[model samples]
Target: MPFWRHPSPSLQPLSLLLLLGTLPLLCSAATPGQLPAKRIQPLPASNLGSGRVETKGPGLYELTAERRAALETIRYAEGTWKGGSSIGYRILYGGGTFNSFERHPDTVVVKRYASAAAGAYQFLPGTWEAATRSLGLSGFGPASQDQAALHLIERRGALAELDRGVLTDQAINRLAQEWASFPTASGGSAYGQPSKSVEQLRAFHRESLRRHQLRREGAPA
Candidate 1:
């Protein structure tokens, strides 16, 4: 693979390329081999008719069709179950409200979403292709090993991209393997009170999205 090159400062990754709807994407400067589903498209208009949804902050972007969508808030989780490998839960919540990780073999790295208070989700590092039954404060589990790629979470709020980024071969296999291991676990974030009232749930997402825009646009949390 070519050396990793960051996108130009002007080439903002959070901007949306609204096709039929919205696809969140950015061509990897290192390898523009195959374009990803969440592709970065130029904003044809300087003002793309967006509101709080797209203007909040954080690295998240929204897709607008009949209505504008808050982007990147949904949390897509992937991890091991036992020695057998496992797929994690799927959840969507406001930035920094509550977020975490769990590993089985190694030490569990605790992470918090600073997106709201600090304007960015405090990221946690996971080793590729290594499984550990470790757990964190915001989240839980001494998760199993799945030999997956880097666990990816979409920027809190956008529908753009698949929402999870585990592209390398090992990561892909681990994700697929773990996803295969526990079909139900891979289904949704039914693990906690991510939502109760549908509207509140919806608002959690909306609030997250606005914050995403704000973070992206350089607003402090």
Candidate 2:
């Protein structure tokens, strides 16, 4: 069963704004005193398969090479990653874990901090609800999560730049407001928590892009 029903169109914008505004205080990738988790290994190529993702609005968004790499880069910074393993989709906030994908884990992890964030993109319950409604997405599977994350990037107005393989400072800054793990232009977390440096994210993005390009060219990644 879907955990969220579609919100009325009339109320969507205001509701989404309120939910997103709380992200900075509620969505830190790691709690205080802990560094973001490092990637254990690369995800299998099978995990990178492309799919057609539909939006509530007109036009379709395919998971293209550059978009996939950009999504992976965001995953890398978000600490929910374990080499892009499926386990990342089961992670709860504050190092806890869950086993279901029927819905957002909605488990408020309390340790150094408390948050209901879960999955590869660390979506809070409200944020996830908003995303599902906005993108007409269902389930909490890896594919759905990826679509939702991309929807977020699109909403932040950074998806075009990312698709162009240009992760400009402006794009990163726009995204930083939504994902605390991404650093702002001034190289700091919007929430004042630890964040990945722009250089680090750029390096990861470059490597990911290279791998995707190689795969596209039918060569070894």
lDDT of each: 0.23, 0.70
My TM-score estimates for the predictions, one after another, are 0.22, 0.76
Q: Count the backbone clashes (under 3 Å) in each candidate.
A: 41, 0
Q: What is the lDDT of residue 171 in candidate 2?
A: 89
lDDT of 2: 0.70
List model 2 lDDT by residue over 1-221, tens digit each. 12223332111233454565431224453221222322222222233333554334453356888998988888888886688687877888776788877788777655544467899889878778766765556578888788778877777779999989877899889888778888888878877677899999899889998999899899999
TM-score of 1: 0.22
- Candidate 1's C-alpha runs over 4 A off are 1-102, 105-197
Model 1 lDDT, residue 204, Cα = 43
Q: For candidate 2, what is the total of clashing residue pairs?
A: 0
